[model samples]
Target: DVGCGYEAARQMRRRGRIAPQHWPHVVAASRRLGIAGVSYEWLAGRAAMQRAAVMQGEAA
Candidate 1:
């Protein structure tokens, strides 16, 4: 599906084909790679946990 959409856009370049327009695909790929969906709250919590672990000097 990605390739198909890319090819279709490529074929319509003269009509302003949008490159890198497959954001959903990119997000899916990122999620599949064990990437964290981080937010400010999540990051703060994670940092706190890590800091606590480091302060204790044990495996987090």
Candidate 2:
């Protein structure tokens, strides 16, 4: 769950050109999960989530 969350955050950070507060949460989760690196493919898919959130006027 954290890997997916981190990837989503990473994508959002890139698209918005702003670091999110949750980044620290993501990092902490990554350490706990022991993932080597976040998956780019997973991160890329976050664009869809971002778009959907925006359309719904909700946080991504």
Candidate 3:
């Protein structure tokens, strides 16, 4: 699922890790799969802090 991949990417980014550079591929895949409301920029913007909060079980 695109949503799952996106979340995994976000988590990878959060841990100061390097995920494969697959944004464009993911975007295309999402579009083909009819996954709507997927904004890469927005996801990237919030990823680090969001992941931190989620990992810690609290608001960032």
Model 3: per-residue lDDT, tens digit, 6-60? 6777886687543436555666777888888655774575667667778889643
Scored by TM-score, the top model is 3
In angstroms, the error of model 3 at 16 is: 12
Q: Write the per-residue lDDT of candidate 2 for residues 6-36, one digit (tens) a residue.
A: 6776886677722444445555676688966
User: TM-score rank, highest first?
Assistant: 3, 1, 2
In candidate 1, stretches whose alpha carbon ends up further than 4 angstroms from where it belongs are: 1-37, 58-60
Off by over 4 Å in 3: 1-20, 50-60
Find the 10 residues in a row with the least total lDDT in model 3: 16-25
Q: Compute each candidate's TM-score over C-alphas.
A: 0.33, 0.31, 0.42
Query: Model 2 lDDT vs. the true structure?
Result: 0.58
| lDDT of every predicted structure (CA atoms) | 0.53, 0.58, 0.63
lDDT of 1 at 35: 66
For each candidate in turn, give its C-alpha RMSD to the true structure in angstroms: 15.1, 9.8, 7.1
Error of 2 at 23 (Å): 0.2
Model 2 spans with C-alpha error above 4 angstroms: 1-19, 38-60
